[model samples]
Structure formats: C-alpha cells, structure tokens
Target: MMLKLRVDNQEIEAREGKTLLQACLDNQIYVPNLCYLEDMESPSASCRMCFVEIEGTPQPVPSCTVQVKNDMVVKTDTPAVRQLQRTALRLLLSVHDVDCKNCHANKKCELQNIAKFLKVGLKPKRLERYLKETLIDETHPFLIHYPNRCVLCGKCVHICRGKHGESVLTFARRGFDTIISTYSATDESSLTCGDCDTCVKACPVGALAVKESS
Candidate 1:
C-alpha cells in the first residue's frame, strides 16, 4: 500500500511499511544517515544522523526508525534536526582519524559526504580527537581492518551475515573501546569469507579492505 507524506512541504508517496528515512530517500529527499541499509529488518539507529521533525512530535526523531504513515508531515531540515545531526557527526569525528588525503575512501567516503551535506567540518572544533592506539589489524588473512577510520556502523557485519548464514566478523568490547573482531584462524579457515569480499565493499568508510596479496 502506498502512503502519502509531506516532507519539507513536498508531497511524496512511499510504501506504508517503509521507514521515513527510506521513504524520503526514495523520493529524492536526502537525510543524513550511516547505520541504515535497505535490507535491514531492524535498523540499529546507532549513527543518529537521520533526524527529522514530524508534526506533533515534541523532539526530532531518527527517521530510520520511524515507519512512514499516511498524510505524515516531516521536516528534514529543521534547526533542531540539524543541531542533533551536527552533534552526532562531531562526536563520530572526535574519535575518527580524519586523514582523508591518504585514506582509500578519500573523496568517496560517506563521512565526508555527510559532513558536506550538513555543512560541518570533518574536524570537531570543540571536541578533542581520540584515535585508537592500534592503527590496523591484519589478523584476517584476506582482509585489513583500520580501526581509526571505522565509524562502527556495522554494515560489514550485517552484509557478512546476510551473505553467509553466520558472520565471522563481530563487534567486540564496549563504549569507546569497541572494535570489530574477526574469527580465529581455525574458524576463519572454515568460513567462506576467504572467497568473499562483500564485507569490504559494504563498508562505507573504507575501513575494511582486501589485502592486495590475497
């Protein structure tokens, strides 16, 4: 069933069960987001970048987690929404290594695109930058993981699990210490990732890369 919604004073039609973020995106309305994928059964909403103001809502909400409804009024460029998005992006940048010149993602990085869209600089002015001590993890025989460049969006993990019944890549630790961990050598040898590069391709930040020799 198609539902009609007014976004930024523009009328759009989206499936009833589609998320507000997806709905807006489908209609050519841009909303900054990182942790959302169209195939996700349940959006993590961890990025907190897709905020929008809906009529009757006291505060801005993450559009990725909200279902589209008929006659819904959404404002994607409200002041409150921009404030939340900027703050969330700044927080991500605080811990992110912003050496884009040398990074593989460079001009194509999602973080850079989001920063441009929000008119926020890649560096956080008020927040002090804190990067992980370990720069790269070559534990995986076929892949290289860059901790500092990672946004912890979990797209790689989700894509891995979707491709294989189970994922060899999983999030480890908690809070600021969180990082993606791969399976043990013995376990990884039995998995199909040796022949797969989906996870690397799914990463929006180029944090994961296929080893050249692999």
Candidate 2:
C-alpha cells in the first residue's frame, strides 16, 4: 500500500507502513536526524530534531515515530517548524558545551550538524555549566563516560535496553537531576555490559563513547 503525503509543499507517495522519517528519506527530503540508528526498528525520538508540522495537528510530530498516512500534509521547513527545531537544539546545546573546535566529534557530530543546519549560534538561555563533573571510566576497555556533556537524550538508554539484551544503562533521578547512569551506578566492567558499544554509538553527542587512545 502507498500513502500520499505532502512535505514542504510537495506531494509524494510512500510506503504505507514506513515511518515518516523513512518516508522522507525514501523521497529524498533529508529530514535532519540524530540518535536514530540507520538499521534499527527503535524510534527513540530522543533528539527531537526530526519534528514536522502535520496538517490538522496543532503540535509538531516526531517524524521518526510517526507513520505516514493518506492525505497527510507535513510542513518540514516552515517558520514554526524552524522555531521549534531551534528551540529543541538550543535546549540540547544549553546542557552541552559550545567547544566544538576541540571536541572529538568536531566534524562528525550530528548535534553540530543539526546546529549548523538550523543556524543556531548560541542558546537564548544563559549557560550554566555544572560544577560537578562526572568521571570517565576507562576500565571497561571499550567505552568512556563524559556525563558533563550528556543531554539526557535517552539514546544510550534505548540502545542498551532495546538493541542489546543487557540493560546496563538507565536514567536515574528526575528533572534537572536526571542523568543516564548504569543500573545501580555500578562499575561497567564489573557487570554484564557485554561491551557491545551500541549505546555509545547510538549517542548523538559525545556523552557515551569509545574514546580514541593516543
């Protein structure tokens, strides 16, 4: 079955059951996305970068999780859409440093690409760097942790708990205090982490990662 939908004022037909992101990519719309694994069934919608305005819908929709429907009209680059996307990116950047020049993923980071695409220079909100920095554990020999740069996107949590059978990481605490930490905040090498690196790879930002050794 094919579903007819409009994106950015252009009408196109796509597979009925595919997600909106899949449909857009299939149609070559290039909807910006991060924290979305290319071949995974999981649609975490953690980054909120693929938001689009759907006809008859007051609020924006997450294209990654939304299934295409007949007569669905979407506005991907409208003023409202841009504003929302900028807001989302700004919020994410608020918790993150603007030091892309010296970062590991300087040229390869999705968050940086999205920020560039949205033309976001700096967040409207004041920057308040956290005083307490999370430690980096290199004992696992496969991954590193830099919680200071974490945006609480839940991508790591999704990949750890969904793609990998081992539930090593999860969101602990709540609200401003919320952070992604291993279950019981225990040492990763001491547990059943499997060291798959799926969570680290799924992370859009450099929160959880396999650091390059010198």
Every model's TM-score: 0.97, 0.81
- Give the alpha carbon lDDT tens digit for every residue of 1-214 in model 2: 9888888888899987788888888888977776565446767787778888898999888889888899898888878778888878777777675667756667777777787888987444565544225545444445676665677777777667676576677777876667676644445446655546777777777777764651
lDDT of candidate 1 over 133-204, digit per residue (tens):
989999888889999999999999999899888898899999999999884744555768767899888898
**RMSD, one per candidate, in order:** 1.1, 3.2
True-structure lDDT of candidate 2: 0.73
User: Which residue pairs collide, candidate 1?
Assistant: none
**Stretches of candidate 1 exceeding 4 Å from the true structure:** 186-188
The candidate that wins on TM-score is 1
